[model samples]
Target: MGDFNQSVVLEAIRRSGEGSSRIELAEATGLSAQTVTNITRRLLDDGLIREAGRTINGPGKPRVTLRLVPDSRFAVGVHLDPAVMTFVLLDLSGAVVRRTSAHTPDMEPRRIVEAMAATIDALITGSGVDRTSIAGVGIAAPGPLDAEKGTVIDPPKLRGWNRVPLQAVLAEATGFPVVLEKDTTAAAVGELWMRRASADDSFVFVYLGTGIGAALVREGEAVRGSTRNIGEVGHIIVDPDGPSCTCGSRGCVEVVCTPQAIVAQAAHAGVFPEDQGMSDVDAVEARLTELCDRAADGDALADGVLRQAAAHMSVLTAALTNMLDVDRVVFGGPFWSRLADVYLREIPDRLERASATRAVRSLPVDGTVVGDDVGAVGAGCVVLDSVLSPRASALLLGH
Candidate 1:
């Protein structure tokens, strides 16, 4: 019961960004003034909220303004990938307060889990945030994940990671609530939470990382199909006679546009070598950064590689826009950061030139402000939203 009230107070503080006066809380929540006051007092005591100046809307009268103490309760987000592991500490306002990252331990499942737990502990202690105030830990891993069981069911890239109960393991280690979601779904959560757009009914979040995939958000929820793998857009066949994908598809977006594919092409072109630490994605990303810097310095090879990659991505994006009737398209992930300028330069032009609806409506395409940590931050939001709204949170959390 007390937990429910605290959640309400925290949510009120989040909604009233500048802080809410006691009166505003009562008005907004329809809770009695006394109830609002009590919740506020408890939140203050819990160090989850604080008074910030005063509301002066009452002419000469002033009411003490209360707002979320951004650092009061922290949530740790973990994004696990084949190439990297990203950890972000988010404050109450969904703002990243601190971050730590390490290379993904591409070992056996047990070894990776052990390493992950140690890394997570180090991050928590390094951040100097209260352990108790950590609402929960959220993990974003490659699909297909069993969110209901908080496990990674089977991920193609992760060898021996089948049916791994990540949430339970993490919870046991940290003694904190832990939640798991497919990386794409986590991206969707981040997109929706940060955008704060309640009007749009259909949109797609395309994540361009080492690979290309998407999360389909329709009617305010991620499109989780019968098996919860609704938006595996990376495998959508764009060219029947093109190259083959690891997913057994030919001429798929992922086969042609992933960072791996781009670097591979550059390697084949002798721009970089197969053994110059560019075989894996993280190494390739480092090389790409150098290449991007070189491209800025007028390196013909690097410039051409990015242009070719962007051209393929533009094709993929055009196909998505034509098929989804998507009101908005969000591009995110690490590769997107490097590819954003190129995509913005070339993709929009391609979309305008090739899109079927180019004559009807504006096709809005933009990069996610939340870059590499998009998945992790969204994972935290999954827990944060749950804590803030009891009924909704309970439904998702299975509480």
Candidate 2:
């Protein structure tokens, strides 16, 4: 009947996975059966939900099951890294239907926005999904951003993106509502939504990309700090006596455990060719992938560099987990595929030894189920979350 009620009913059906009955929806949402019936009628009429046969119990009347129509809606997710831009189209179920990628172009805000809009247009046209059914675009970009204003504020490696009104620009360019979020936070949202995490689940998502960062998710919501810049983990000091960081700190995680740092370490360890110039993002990514491949193939020097990076990552991760009192940690991002094995193996042991709750609970470290595209998919989930997920603010507004 209203936005709040609609979101609650839809969320219940989506969370039900296979399907749910009105009785089940009423129980899950804590709404009256009459209210669930009215909302279900509206959803059915709107084609957002459909009857999926019936469940017949022994002596009672057969109850009809309703399920979300995945084709009823679609959302586009864009993950903009310093090196690459990933685009994904996701359905109501958070399944990626079509995906594409391109090298990040110039840092000029207008050009980047136009390029992204063009890519979105191409994706929608290629997918042949009804244009009206498409929700909007969600962007996951490197942050230190003004999430409330949808502005990019001096993120590393993006030279010209200083206080750029990215959300408004993208909205204007594409004629679609836009939701902008930090890449790590968006990745955490994606994991929570895609995995259908209950409100009780809590975890920290470690995002390994060109730079390293993290997002703390508690009760299925990402912890946005006072300025909505909570996940700046790169600056966390891991080694007090190690190399100096650009943040004017010694042995910061960003300076020691990032992809750039790992590649630099590999180069120093004689993993790359002497003449190879790691001046550009592409060069660094290429060299890093080569190093990971070599390490996987039993190159001792490369393996040692990666293991050392993983160890540094574990320290930061353990600290975050202990401070936040979360039981799980998830790793994801473009660089994650290359470093997942090392992190999984190395982080768990370090966490077990370092965590304050080690005697009470064993923390689990795992990779994202969405794989390397978790950030992009999470971006898309941001849009769906905004539209379908119920929020406390709605109750305050009496929606």
The number of the candidate with the highest lDDT is 2
lDDT per residue (tens digit) for residues 1-399 in model 2: 378988999998999999999998998989999999999999999999999999986788898999999999999999998888999999998899999998888778777888899999999999999889989999999998887888999998788888999999999988889999889999999999978878789999999888888998988788777877888887899989878988888999877888877887887878876666765889889888888898889988988988898888888988898889987999999999998777777778887999899889899888898889999999999999988888876777443
lDDT of 1 by residue, 1-399 (tens): 556666766676686667889888888767788988888887788777888897678576799999887777778888888888888888778898888888877747877778778987888899888888899988888887776777887676677887998889888887888888778878888776676665345787888766677888877667767766666777776667768877887888766777776777777777886667655666777777876776677889888888877778777777877887888778998667777776777777777787888778888788886777898898888777676643333434433
Worst 10 residues of 2 by lDDT: 390-399
Runs in model 2 with CA error above 4 Å? 397-399
For candidate 1, give the lDDT.
Answer: 0.77
Q: Note each model's CA RMSD in angstroms.
A: 3.6, 1.6
In terms of lDDT, the poorest run of 10 residues in model 1 is 390-399
For model 2, what is the alpha-carbon lDDT of residue 76?
Answer: 98
What's the lDDT of the predicted structure labeled candidate 2?
Answer: 0.88
Alpha carbon RMSD to native, model 2: 1.6
**Total clashes in model 2, counting residue pairs 3 or more apart in sequence or in different chains:** 0
Model 2 scores a TM of 0.97
